[model samples]
Target: MQGATRTPAYAGRGGSRSIIALAGTLITVFIVNSLIGLFAIQYAGDADVRDQTTLARLSHALDTAREAQVAFKIQVQEWKNVLLRGGDAKDYDRYLASFEEQERRVRDRLEALAAAAGDLGLDAAAMQAALADHATLAARYRDGLALFDRTHPASVAVVDRAVRGIDRPMDEAIDALAEAARARAAAIRADLEAARAERYRTLRTVAIASMLVGIALVGAILVRTSVRRA
Candidate 1:
């Protein structure tokens, strides 16, 4: 009549409750969604870490296998030295001891490689077979050295001819295992990268969604305040 009609006291409380409700709902949605996004990203990060660990282990195993090959070559070289210079007892004993030591090193490395490969779910059967063949070849070398009568140095030639290329198959097997390991590492790296990218994309999407919702909520609050003032 004289001016605007008076608002009931309960009406102001009701309006306040409405603003509170609206803010609470939007805030809750924003917080809950952000928490979920963080948890999801953490899970993805854990998975990526596990994959990287696997790749590292495989790489170490491959290195162990290669080292085993190098030790085997050294063992073979010692065997050759034993043949050439072993006419003397002292030289023969030293060369034979060196040969035996290198053989032990090779075996140890291969054993480590096998264990690592098996743990990583790789097939080590071919490498194991190669190791067995190496044992046979080593035995022949031992026998050849034993037969070296202080009189017959030419018998080394007979032993050499017999075991000339016995290592070819084992060499091939090691190469195959290395190739397989490389392929697996590549696949793991690719998968890890993809997972990282996906994680980033999901996080970006959540951030964008939250920002938009916040902007809308601010706009709504400003409008409601203006309406209340009016």
Candidate 2:
């Protein structure tokens, strides 16, 4: 007698549903982890941008403020030279021209520093006061120079006296501005360091969370596969 052939049963709908659910869970975990990574990257980029901006503003403030101080000193020296060597008309003219050049340089640097401070959302009031003092000093020098021009070789005493009266205050104001700029720069550096540390911490947290999630999802998928096989 011929035996009837039996057909093997198809895989059940329950097994298919289990596979679908596992796939969905894995996809969801991947998406969540990817979002976390992307968010961390974006946050780090934002922090970097902020740090760069702070560094640029601080550099501009400090460097330009110092350069302006040097230029003002040169101006003061030229003022002294005008008093000492202006007996000759040509020497007076040369020294006066040099003084004017230095004045222009100082003004330019001050403007640049003020602009940088403003851009950094800082108060330029202190810098403005220094600029005002500079203007007063320049006016005094101009008056002294004019007096010297009319009474060359004889107005030395008057010019010296005027410069002597103004030099200390003028230097003090410039020094104050530079000191303020230095203080501001130090604060910016601290902020940058803090931001850097924060970014590292955030990245580490995200990495650890992602690793744990990945491990859990993999374990779940392995269990599901084994169950399906069994």
Cα lDDT listed for each candidate: 0.76, 0.79
Best by lDDT: 2
TM per model? 0.80, 0.82
In angstroms, the error of model 1 at 1 is 9.0
In angstroms, give how far residue 122 of model 2 lies from its true place. Answer: 4.5
Off by over 4 Å in 2: 1-12, 121-123, 149-152, 218-230
User: What would the per-residue lDDT of candidate 1 be over residues 1-230, giving only the tens digit for each residue?
Assistant: 88989988977886887788678867776787778678877877787788778778878876777787778778878888888888899998899899999898887876786676677666678657767877877787766666666568777787777667776776676667667666766776787788778877877887777777777776787687667757
Which window of ten consecutive residues has the lowest lDDT sum in model 2?
Answer: 5-14
Alpha-carbon shift of residue 43 in model 1 (angstroms)? 2.1
lDDT of 2 by residue, 119-205 (tens): 665458866776787888788777766666545456788767766768778777777788878887898788789879977997898
Q: Please estimate how well model 1 matches the true structure, expressed as its whole-model Cα lDDT.
A: 0.76
